[model samples]
Target: MRCVANTGRMSRGECSSIRAASDVGTAVELGAVVSQWVGRVVPHEGYMLAAVDPVTGVGCFLAREHGYSQAAARRLIVGDRSDGDHPYPFDRRARQSRVGVFNTDAPGLRRNEAMRDVMLDQGVGSELRIALAHAGTMWGGLVLLRPRGARPFSADESVQAQRLARDIVAAMRRYAAAAPPEPSGLALPPGVLVIGTGGGAIAAERVVAATPSAREWLDELGTRPADALTTSDPPVESIVWILTQTVRTTDKPAMTRVPTKRGWIVLNAQPLTGGTDVAVTVQPAVGTDLLPAMAFWHGLTPKERAVVEQVLEGLAAKQIARRLEMSPHTLNDHFKSIYRKLGVSAREELIARLLR
Candidate 1:
């Protein structure tokens, strides 16, 4: 990854502005507040703030966009997914530099297979990508886009974005610790969503078919009108397409847990017709799917989560300490912190909260 020298600093007023935005609370409110602030500082035509999955590096869970058409956003996300296959993927680049620039005319664009074509097609000249990570865990990402003929994002502006990232991501982490969404009332069984490509000079993609229950999940997710399915109108459709691409490339099932307003739903995709098409199944997320996210929601540090895992296995404190290569005193301290953060007083309480 290339490193940018710190050529400038943000003013105290600008720093305070970001702090205020972080304090606004909730993912939606944070996006609205921070997007406006970023536009003022960076001069972008479109903005996206998303809460991404730390493990998968996918941002379909919770996202808010402004000033971008549905079609454009869908294409951009689909293109970004293919970028994941690059030798130097977005997550690694983001880890190296919290803020980075993407230019359509750069020589590196050719190395990026999918993003280049999408950027060219969309007439996007430049993009500023900010990784919303805290203490080595990625909470989400922010993207600012400029159209063709616009000036490329400058090094100084990138420095400003880097400065703003810490506060913004810290707020997003707090938002992640909030309660999970409620359960969807509909008790329908798991359903299928089929995806395939049409014959064209450029293989246009479409939703080939979907089960009734799958359609219910789409409606529950608030996807665009039925006409939009062929073109992949909503963000959810972008996620489905991304999973399809993954299944085709790896010849293995691809899966993700999507958090909707009602609750989390598991989406699993498998290749069909020798990878010519992909079938995605939608169902309620189970305990395994919810456990990792549960630790995140309670703001458990990685080490603390390790301790919780041992507890779930019914290990004694001394046994867990020995297994984790920590002293009993240190283990006790971790327990105290976990209990305080989770608002639990005992091991049984902790288990109940986690299982629930």
Candidate 2:
């Protein structure tokens, strides 16, 4: 219920609209709502909204308007040659604050080859970036762009955008809390699902020796064989593909967690020895793998999480109370709060939500 700082131009109705949008069902619906809000509030010609992987800072889902060419978008998404040199890289900004503005007229910007090319090609002059973070993990981002000669975004506007981003994060957490339990029919047990990848022209990129489990996990993430070229701008690549590509090119291990209808699935990649190939392992995330993010998404306090962990381990209420050195009454209160925040009525439901 935090209010936007007094940005004189915002109407009471506009604020209410954003608050309502926060309760929308999915990230895509929320993005569409925010796009309309930004059009009226900050006045931008182009926008990009992404659900990003916090650990790897890679996009898991994206929607954009008036976007860069596929070439440029790929560079930006993969950090090929575009990101590290930018004045306000997403990774660096994620560590500092939720909102930032970048102007092409800034001294060093024009000197940056990647930044200069994108701005020149897109005919944009000002960029406002919002990193939507909650409980220390970034879940998404919003970027707004204005054409050349438009006034640069001001400090006050950045403040306004920060407030909006905060609301967006809050909504995302609630959505996560209410997400349906991971499907059990898939019965994909907790084990390594192997996938192999080769890099080159999009046509040449391929998935080799992918198992049925691997394919199921890939399908859950909406991934296709690298050759299934879609006609969309910034052609889609699953987080698995992205991690494999990252590991192949960087010669290092790469890992990221992606949200799926089933739950969070962990993708881990490593350069396979003796070739230009990478191996990616996909599996259901364990409690440790998902704990911090679940805590963040459900707004659970540390004590509440401790109680949940014990409950997941099949502890009795009294045993948990004794272990945590809390009275039975206090333990019950914590359970109540955890259940409410997580939108679960009992320990079994809480375990299902968290354990996948």
lDDT of 2 by residue, 37-114 (tens): 766667677777776555566555555666454446554554433244544444413553467776677521242556
Q: In lDDT terms, how accurate is model 1?
A: 0.64
Report lDDT (CA) for all predictions. 0.64, 0.62
- Per-prediction TM-score: 0.72, 0.75
Clashes of each: 1, 0
**How many backbone collisions does model 1 have?**
1
Cα error, candidate 2, residue 214 (Å): 5.2
Clashing pairs in 1: 182-262
Clashing pairs in 2: none
Q: Name the top TM-score candidate.
A: 2
Q: How far is candidate 2 from the true structure (C-alpha RMSD, Å)?
A: 5.3
TM-score of 2: 0.75
